[model samples]
Target: MSQLLEPFREAYRNMELLPLLTETALKKFWVEYGTETIEELEQLVEDSPSGDSKIIFAGHRGCGKSTLLAQFGRRMADKYFVVFFSISDSIEMSDVNHINILFAIAVRLMEEAEKQKIKIKPSIKEQFYKWFAKHTRTEIEESQAGVGVGFDLFKIISGKLKADATIRDEIKQEFNRKISDLIARINEIAAVVQGASQKEILVIIDDLDKIDLGVVRQVFEENVKSLFQPNIRVIFTVPISALREVRMAGTLTTETNNQIVIMPVSKLFKQGERYINNSEPISEAIAMLTDVMYKRISRDLIEPEVVKKIIIYSGGVLRELVRITNQCCRICLRLIRRKPDDLDIKINAEVLQEAITNISIDFDTRIGNADYELLQQTYQFFTPNDPKEQRFLDLLHGLYVLEYRNAKLWYDVHPIVTEILQRKGKL
Candidate 1:
């Protein structure tokens, strides 16, 4: 009895609530969208004259965009020396700068180079620490000889700069003063990576999309030139909300040469005047959604109809699906104790609806009727066109409004959110 419950307990204990970072998890739960997004990126890299490209990829938070980028880096590892890192992992999202981003990239590059037995010049390290210490007004602590000095130095610099706002500002000013030098050092590291791997360096900086919209504007809009100045093949994740607000001519535009690529949501619904599941082609989207749960837990442990209901509620967003499924697992455990049905340990519709009801309660806390109508129309029809409908962007970020693609793009409120609205006669 204990042995049977152990796997069930452990699976939830090790549930991947965040993006998949390891290759093993990625392989076991991977799903193909039949979307050529990665292929387009590869083609761009292959056809580039200088073997260098800078791109901005945007998607809603928790939309598996990070997972997609990570898979891309893994797939192209043979041809491109891929170094993927998350910016928010090292810096505070509320207060981020392009310089902080560049610094993180440089540190990650150095780390990757060391992994590949390539050495970064000690002079570059010394120069970086010198500038860092000068701006922060701190004395460099003495270190034991050859005691992982590079690694220790990196930790100290990143830790201090992120924590101390005064130090961060000073460093930003210093970085601005020596922006050209910083660029040179970054390019120098890029050169080594390309030379050692016999391929171009591809840096996928993930999690920038998870930052605040204001910071997104600061990094990609106001400072677009500086952010894109790094002389390397790079892809930076931007927030989906930024696309509707920022001027796109230089960075994100329809121009063939523009660097931005709006990775549309992996298509789930068929194109029509009305929304319907893409069942005619008989794709395995539903199966992929189920496989994600099975990869973590046993299939028989979960009822197929329960999983299907959760998938529909997820509105085809991968993170939303995982979240709802996680809730359902909890519901199943509670229901199992009441009934003691060891022979049929599965979630059912009643518990699934209860789980969704709990989630919907949170959705009801702050919405006004005007916002409710905006959400309703956005969910039912095409995406709302009124710039005043910025509340919809908030809904998008909050996972209440899901972005989807047919021939063009559209938005729909999360099933649970809509359920709450309809229950109130607003939809």
Candidate 2:
């Protein structure tokens, strides 16, 4: 085909929907969208000279929280012995709670120290290893398991912790009643690591937010104090919907000295604007979202009109922006394959609409009477006044609604959801 259009084939082939977890992917696609929030978080830890510093934060699912967190970990690497991990990688999301979370943290801390060769006394390592074996029901035939031998065994136990339901339930059952015992173990490990490394331990627990809201309420609202009792500095993430709940918000701020650090969706339009104004100044947030798209593909492959509409429809959620554009690229490539002679074909308005319609259809299946009723209520004013409503919370969790922050925080139905609601005469 022609040289200009040939690049589209390569760009479209390289799109991805998952979070930027690897070093190389992040370097290529990461943009500076949440500088203020990250700075505020950094300040929170730096200012806390004594004891543990725990910060609970929230963001919408696709708002680049995971990617931003990777950046944060890299930023804080020199000052703290950073151990960052997502909860889902270790435990099942449906079974996640504070107990398992602490369990995972302890496991990860040792794993990290071992991987990084951070010096801990051999006696301490052996003690921690035996404790893990006892809790995981792995018996030691040998009286004394060497540190090297123990790590190899612990890897097996760690695999069971992630995959075997029986072990998870047993650990939860065992620790549920004696939470102090578990926290004591966590604090002990943290203290040992900090003492050995000469830096405070910072554990960034990502994707705890992806669990059910009821469990979130139980974890943060009721048991938050227990989660923070460990000596290490920790960052816990919740879904943006969980943070908006009245009781959850109050408990977090009141119990913890620091306010929740929110990674907000980049706003493509002014809070009050109904439509994108061509002559208006393009906000930095909008540029961040668009740049995320252009970074993955050649800008010439997709029409500017298509990109603009996708941004608005994305509702400033980074995942949506990537997903929609990625799908558009996929559709364009498939069409090009169907008509191999068409060198003029690119991602056009029709391709954009096709991708949009396919996604809207998926949302259509998920929306119900309760969701639609809540959507009708908050379609215009997605205020915090009634943020505790379960239906509204579900909408936020499902991304049927998108939340944004400004001088005042507000919400709106997802652009695709809004169109669906309008067509249903609910808005």
Candidate 3:
């Protein structure tokens, strides 16, 4: 690669593309979606009484759920004893059941309790271990025969809970049989934590959205009450794809005092007789996203128009925007190696177009004709019934269609999805 390309490549390599977690990372990587969604969610939680409360927040997988939830956690940390965790990190997401969720939360709660120097009653600890030992007899016996010297029972239990499917199933079945007991034990610990901390326990379980649709439905629909019946303030991050499959709207509304919040895509357009790109919101969003990359990489590596094009192609999906930007950097690296002039090397329009074309190929494979028609209709009419339409949900799940909230809500097809269909003369 030419010398000019070297600096650009180096800068691109240093860019932070992963999800933000730390306070510093969030400060550096933040982008305002310019909606009252976060405040509204906070308000609901703040206004509610200090009893068992659950809020269901759904968004597209990469549409900034983790970062937003983390932010929410920080905002509530001062007032609430927050236990924020990502479930997919520990459990089998595709096969996750309500039992898996409960165990994950229990493990996390135990860890946070230890961190905060809050002690669980010895009787409660013994009760928890007894429950574990009774349900996981085979696992305990196997571990005893293998590595029994000074074995920490809780450690063994936690490992088996995450790794052993049979153990997990047994615990799940036992919990199902004696759910009331399990609920009582959870409440006992929750009471202790709340009493010790002098604040309500706010359990923010993130990444339930990453699980399979079947698992999502099973945990949230078939057993919504079971999953959410715990006596703690809970906020679950659910996937946009599984939103329609969830059948507990009324139940969740009544239970959590109606704190369901949906984080929509950043508004990039104003829908009317003709779909017009709303320059102001679109520019502000693009500029903020551009800053995310520029914080690590030099903006000189990318042309301004190229950045705008990439953001447009992303269709306000923050993850997609960063992903395409990363792809462009890679493509630029390869192209720079073959180019004659080092100074001419830059992430230009052609490089972005090539990157988007590659992404469009994948979209083509995943999106079906019905999804295409739904996206097409969403692009044109912005129909009143569109949000409720099942096909519309399909398109949203596929990321073929994007949702945005302005003075009102609207839907539009991802620009890359639209571009590919137009290229094939299908639009």
Candidate 4:
């Protein structure tokens, strides 16, 4: 699978490597990257004393939370009616709020229930059709009123809700003044559906973290109670950096009464040790990351040591790791285009360094003097002086600062950002 001879396959593989949002991560690059984190989440969900567990799954943007959550949701399907969907597919990130979020859940609930062919009373199903039709301003004719019709209606309306701004705004206005009513309706629908399906409802909402932090603060901080009012188990994703805010973290923990579960970035080195101290990275984590590479691209395309170097530069973020390697592939592809007669088309030190230089420029440009100062201190101390400062949090959000979990939570500058600092004489 060298992909060099097959232009179409090479293009498809290149697209896969870009840092895009996808649900088929586990299906494709089936790495044992975060099974421990998934197992922990399973216990948090399945074994909850109160069945209505609302969990906040926080992690770096590209830390494989979606893949882990996909597996978690699949495992839950046997006993619970699993409703896994990305909020980005429903509402525009800028326009998202607590009201529209619950609205999306209710719509998705009915849609999934229909797909699963759950036997709900016709009256309850009609109520759902009418409720969605009323809020979304769509008409559901009485003649078109069976499971097949209801499924088709919701399918069309779901697309409109995602692709149409008018429907989203109408629903927002209809429920914005009295969100409790929205919560009540959701609970009512969930109750009937659960009774019919004979399983508890588990809603796993992804992509909520990709929104701006300000918007996340509004939906999560201002209306956290409303978010949990539906009486169904739910999992909400938030930026790992958002938890750095003491009030936000304190509020979520206080409300949930449990520790917030964070999917950690892959821990490469031990705390307070880098590559220089004769200190090796955790072998298991490194192997997991390397295994991920072997699955995607052949080892012949890149050297083993080169893959490890790319991983270190990736700061253990799966998306970044794939992206840097993808860059090398594109570099080699360009060279072959210029001269396909060359026998050796593999990625070499020159190509790998070029990839590093290309990605570092992006990080180098977004960072500022203040961010650099914070990075330098974080590099030296392995912790930010003011972890709660928005600037520091920005670094965390931007992946300029990476948080690693081993014995404790420790912070360090991202390897790419670190190299930039060294070149700038700041480290």
Ranking, lDDT, top scorer first? 4, 2, 3, 1
Cα misplacement distance, residue 301 of candidate 3 (Å): 1.0
Candidates in order have lDDT scores of 0.70, 0.80, 0.71, 0.82
lDDT of 3 by residue, 9-96 (tens): 6666654356777898778657665247788778778877756778889887678888888888888889998998877665666558
Best by lDDT: 4
For TM-score, the strongest prediction is 4
lDDT of 1 by residue, 59-154 (tens): 777778887888888888888788898886667777788887887777777656655645445555555556545655656753411335655655
How many clashes would you count in candidate 3?
Answer: 0
Clashing pairs in 3: none
- Write out the backbone clash pairs for model 2: none
TM-score of each: 0.87, 0.92, 0.85, 0.94
lDDT score for candidate 4 against the true structure: 0.82
**Prediction RMSDs, each to the true structure:** 3.3, 2.7, 4.2, 2.3
> Candidate 2 — worst ten consecutive residues by lDDT sum?
274-283
**In angstroms, how far off is 161's CA in candidate 3?**
3.3
lDDT, residue 166, model 1: 76
Q: For model 2, what is the error of residue 80's alpha carbon versus the real structure, in angstroms, after optimal superposition?
A: 0.3
List ranges where model 2 is wrong by over 4 Å: 1-14, 139-154, 275-281, 382-385
Report the Cα lDDT for residue 227, model 1.
71
